[model samples]
Target: MKVQVLLRTEGELAVVVGEAEGETWPEMQTVLPALLRGVADRVEAHGEVPDAAP
Candidate 1:
């Protein structure tokens, strides 16, 4: 499976992409959420999340 996400903040833009292969559907399900969480974590670590609604 593969995932791609685009992040835009302030005046900057970035792209995050990842891919992994799973032997079964259950494994694939796990891999997908893990991949997405990793991406979200990376973005948060960079302070991409705003404190207040815009």
Candidate 2:
């Protein structure tokens, strides 16, 4: 499994580019989420998120 990260004006996107070894999107449904979870964790840790202000 090959994974890559990309930066865009809109936001960041997780891109996985690899040769087809059979199941694609269906498999992506599972694989992608796990990958995204890791990315989200890191983002939450390093990024400065704005807190709610009242």
Candidate 3:
């Protein structure tokens, strides 16, 4: 599987986008959280914290 991740930040807020091809929706869904967490971890390492949904 191939995954692509995009990150956007505005001040202290950050948004993440993840994309993958060659996978079923269920398969993609299963892998997304880990991908997103990895991206989030990298972003946070640079001192940007993503906004939490309320």
Candidate 4:
């Protein structure tokens, strides 16, 4: 199985996109948590940093 995830920041919000391929549920189960955690970390970091004054 193959899994890919992307996280993007837009203004004060964030977007998460994920994809899974192949028929390997077991592998996905093992990797999904880590992938989700990475996205969460990025979102948290983005939240902690204030936007530049406009």
Candidate 5:
């Protein structure tokens, strides 16, 4: 199965859109969460520092 996920961000908010081919919706159900969580984990691992006060 092949899946493509698109993420869009506006300021501090984000939206996720996903597309899959050669896979059933139910199969995508399982794949999506794992894929998202992996992404989240990677982002967290990278860490971020807040901007300094102006």
Candidate 6:
């Protein structure tokens, strides 16, 4: 899988994420929680973070 991080703002941010080709959405779903938590923590602590896209 490939992970791309994006900085949205000083206090709020977004993560631009995508998996490698042939990866299933279900598979990605498995790790979403961890990814989101990590992003939230980083955003809170650092003021900028990245996460999965809608």
What stretches of model 5 exceed 4 Å from their correct place?
6-22, 48-54
Off by over 4 Å in 2: 1-3, 7-22, 51-54
lDDT of 6 by residue, 1-54 (tens): 544445475576654532232276777667767666666666567544356343
lDDT (CA) for every model shown? Answer: 0.64, 0.49, 0.69, 0.66, 0.61, 0.56
TM accuracy, model 4: 0.52
**Across residues 1-54, which tens digit of lDDT does each residue of candidate 1 receive?**
443445556877665555677677777777787677776776677676877222
- The candidate scoring highest on lDDT is 3
TM-score of every candidate: 0.50, 0.43, 0.53, 0.52, 0.49, 0.47
Candidates sorted by lDDT, best first: 3, 4, 1, 5, 6, 2
| Candidate 3 structure quality by residue, lDDT tens digits, 1-54 | 666777866765445466666557778788788788877676677875669321
The better candidate by lDDT, 3 or 6, is 3
For model 3, the local distance difference test gives 0.69
Clashing pairs in 5: none
TM-score of 3: 0.53
Model 1 regions lying over 4 Å from their true place: 1-16, 51-54
- Ten residues in a row with the worst lDDT in model 2? 14-23
In model 3, which runs have C-alpha deviations exceeding 4 angstroms?
Answer: 1-3, 8-22, 48-54
* Residue 26 C-alpha lDDT in model 6: 78
14: Cα error in model 1, Å? 6.8
Error of 2 at 19 (Å): 13
Error of 2 at 49 (Å): 2.7
Q: Which model is ahead, 2 or 6, in terms of TM-score?
A: 6
**Per-prediction tally of clashes:** 0, 0, 0, 0, 0, 2
Candidate 4's C-alpha runs over 4 A off are: 11-23, 48-54
